[model samples]
Target chain A: MTTAGSPLVGSSGRGRVGRRRARNRERLVSAAAELMAEAGVEGVTVSAITERADLGAGTFYNYFQSRDGIVDAVVAGAVETLGQRLDALTQGMADAAEIYSSSLRHLMRTAVTDPLWGRLVVRLGIAHDQLIATLGPRARRDLLIGVDSGRFQVPDVDIATAITFGALLSAIHAHLGSDQASDPSGVFAESLLRMVGIPAEEATEITQRPLPPLPSLEEARVILGGDAEG
Target chain B: MTTAGSPLVGSSGRGRVGRRRARNRERLVSAAAELMAEAGVEGVTVSAITERADLGAGTFYNYFQSRDGIVDAVVAGAVETLGQRLDALTQGMADAAEIYSSSLRHLMRTAVTDPLWGRLVVRLGIAHDQLIATLGPRARRDLLIGVDSGRFQVPDVDIATAITFGALLSAIHAHLGSDQASDPSGVFAESLLRMVGIPAEEATEITQRPLPPLPSLEEARVILGGDAEG
Candidate 1:
């Protein structure tokens, strides 16, 4: 589906080139994700990415114009389906508090169980453009819902959103740094719910409520209609 | 007094030499502080520091063994007086909530009014060892008081401390990034106070209360018995 002769589209003009281009892009994105998860955004290099993918250095340029292009692709590829999954999980939930709590809980839980996702996020910190682009508006949307429903007493939704984003990154960084055994997703969400004006007891209850299973990546992609070829 | 013939202590062996060494060390620390406050922790280098201090490159090694040494000195020199000043400001306050709010307010207010201090802190973030070493304990100490006095209902002091540290940095980053005219320190502290179980009304009241002046660095030094030369 990419334009002809685009570096990311590869130089091969054969009938199967489109399929090959897509697969190559996927490989490049995953390689960048792994490196980001391991050493952070600043640690990534085009050479390192190509090396990790076991592709020729020149093959990298055939697929990406720069390191930033690959980084964006990695974030978009990872977050698009997950964002859809979160929306699906929170659908039809009337309680805005529960909706917010559920979304945050899922993120925290995934960070714990999914090393690649966790490290990528931790390395990115709170200032990565792609992360904010993908999740910032989603968080604000849920927070606004709570405010509109009178379920939360936030002073300013924008400030609250910033706090929530920072708090999540910090909490995850702390959780991963320590040897603490218990899953902190519940506690982390509880703390933020309270910050947004939910009472302690209610916030605790909402966070501890059984979380539904996250849709698998393949399922999420299908649900999101992300398979361009099929 | 530093041991004789130490690289960190300088090789000069005379009465005036010790005084000169102390003066040069102070100069280097301030130079580093200025650079860090301008360009962040990562931006300062030994060459830049010496250049800013107007000292020879080799002179930097006379007092500091490495760049890390100067960085620590800068943080210590800056934070020590500020920490003591905060202690003086909050002394004899009976209400733990007020004490906590006051401390946080002072920190936030400083960040807004003092551009140098603000930039330095925003650059440091939460994980900088020097920052955590200075502000981390003070925050925890005040938080523990609130918890002990039944004024706060924190689930975990350590986690709360981590959250507060991260939230402050993030909030400041957000605030500075925007052109909002109003000071956010009060609202920021109020939100945290509420998170720790203070009722919204009470948190607002506590945060909005009159803030006392921070003791000057000199006065704080006197209070701390920090006159090493004497």
Candidate 2:
């Protein structure tokens, strides 16, 4: 019952109620993400997400509108979150090569650090329209930036974007398959930089350069605002 | 049907019977390949294969052991055939860069010339075991050859193999998605060559070199022996 005096719906306890709601929503999203990674997009359903989150089925409606709603939440929290961070990280960087390399290195490192997130993106496959829609523009933007600056000798920005998208997912799969590998992110970034026409020596050096950290989720929520409300 | 003089079961018509069986098996495999390309590995079925081939239900058992048997036949006809041809084409090549570029160019061209095959491979995704098993080792071998010959500057071969496997499929998906792009094969192969550490100028020249034609299916059957027997 959403009574006027009930704490959840009551204005008197609004701050605590909002925190609890957000926490439940985050739990639901994380649960859906885990299931999607283990299986694929088809594996996620409302019952599955709610059960995984250990929340009552009735509570699901309080946050998400449907199975697909939670799915988008998961994407926003994973792919979009990272994309926003990459955007923020590269915003002021002058070297387009470094900008591209940093974004990719962070992506490769995700498989090592946040494996569930990594596996989820890899599971979506390249053809998943939402996945393509989210990452494609960011990839194109980065490549085009490099092309505009004459830092990259790309044959076609579209082809290079496709190459980056494909290479990133496959490389993540390979990294997850093998537990022990030496500095995969560096190797991956170096190879991609070279593909975009950076000299081998310079690509190596740029990938070796220290990468700035992604902003914390709190900062991202503030920066990204509506894009990551879930 | 089992009468002593029935042509299909009679000894005197053995040659024609064998030819008919081979043709039927080819038809079944082709049907399965087309379905697999349009849907995915899980999309194939005995009935579906027979239905697509316009053959009677009874005829399916005469050719394949099971649904999986025909799927294997499809892989044998597609991925393995291409792998064998690449092996043949690169047998005496002195430049590892050209060998790599030529093999990639042909793979890219498959998307343009025979799109169904390309779609099937891309649909299989990077995590597909059979696709990886068939293509991964060849990619690793090519990279290692380049590395050992001092012709490439790969940071690590395993990462590069993953990149190639991922890049090839993703690039094919990209090429198939866009119908009017100019010489995607050359663009893809050229970028890959650069990724493996060839300089921009030389990578362009290598990709532009005249690529040898893949051996005919009959010749591939002779050369690859059991690998191409679908």
Candidate 3:
């Protein structure tokens, strides 16, 4: 296991060292997220992260260029996680109300459970122009596909998508910020469906049930187009 | 007429002096808004506002206690003006869709024409939750009356009103923030109507035309009950 003159080699050497490095990086990221959640993004610092991770200052630098880099990483990770969750939740919903209600619930639950991440996402999504530009198109495309297929009654797909999403996020922000007693997600979803012209009775029925399955990939392709399919 | 030793104790004297003070305060607010529009709120300063108003530092303090006070005044003034405009625009709307569309369009036009005020409203609105709490309920009650009278199909009037209003504001923010090619007001109004489950085609038609007159105050009370009417 020990070699003095020879260079460290193969599985026992480079592989083990690489694994250690990856673990260290993972630890740093986790520590950063935890710190941010507890103390807010503004309160987190390099020294605090290092202290939380039980790593030295030099080790922290080895993984991240700066605190901003860590924040970027955290945001990216959170976005990826949210995208995956949404995909899973919306995999096969035929009814527009069902899809909207389910997605709204999922999003609201995520925001409530992980409020710091939610706030960060909303702040980055709305307040930061560049981030919105980068993410808006993809989000719009997903929403339009849902609307175009009669799953939703939205006339102006793009505008409806933006407004609905923004309202949901804002409602979440308000709910989390206040001590008001109500299921914000339920209220948000119910209200949004109502605004889109879904009948009151129908909105209640859809929101009360579990969301239906999304279309198969083939059906999704037909609706979303070949480019979106890929 | 010029008063010598004793001030003229007449209506004209007090009215003239009051008008002068109001004019000076108006000029100061206009100057502050201009500076904020050019530079962001963070960049605006008392000295810059005074300079823009062509007033001395002492005069600036005479009207505003500090930069925060001036900002608050500006925000309050803008909200009041917008609220009045909304009241006028939606005064005669019997149909909820028509009311929502007209009100949304009016708000969007105001936001686009005076982006600085829009930014300030959004910032202050979010930062100070009390602002919306004070304004939102009354506007919501008016819309709810239409719902109760069978003009709209909202199940939960309060939640629907919140989502509709919230969506309208968000849509305007998105349109103004992006390079998207569409009339922000038209698109926002259309989207808002669609969200409530109104068929897109019908939404388009309703939004394009003027709305009918709302019920009288007594009639609204009979329909929505005293709690909602109040």
Highest TM-score against the true fold, candidate: 2
lDDT of 2 at A119: 83
TM-score of chain A of 3: 0.71
Off by over 4 Å in 3: A1-70, A92-98, A121-125, A130-135, A177-181, A194-199, A211-230, B1-24, B34-60, B92-97, B122-131, B179-181, B197-201, B210-230
- Candidate 2's residue-wise lDDT over A1-230, tens digit each? 01001111212445776868867877777788889999887767888888988999889998878888777767766776577767777877898998899999998887778777678888888766778878889999999999999989998788889889999999998888886445489989999998998888888999998878888555665676667544
Model 2, docking class: medium
| Candidate 2 local distance difference test against the native | 0.79
The CA-based lDDT of model 3 is what?
0.60
The residue-level lDDT of candidate 3 at B68 comes to 83
What's model 1's lDDT at B164?
Answer: 81
Tell me the docking grade of candidate 3: acceptable
Error of 1 at A153 (Å): 0.8
- In model 1, where do residues sit more than 4 Å from their true spots? A1-24, A78-81, A216-230, B1-27, B34-39, B51-57, B221-230
**Model 3 chain B weakest lDDT span, ten residues long:** B1-10
By TM-score, rank the candidates, best first. 2, 1, 3
- Using lDDT as the measure, the top candidate is 2
Interface RMSD of 1: 1.5
Q: 1 or 3: which has the higher lDDT?
A: 1
Which pairs clash in the backbone of model 1? A7-A62
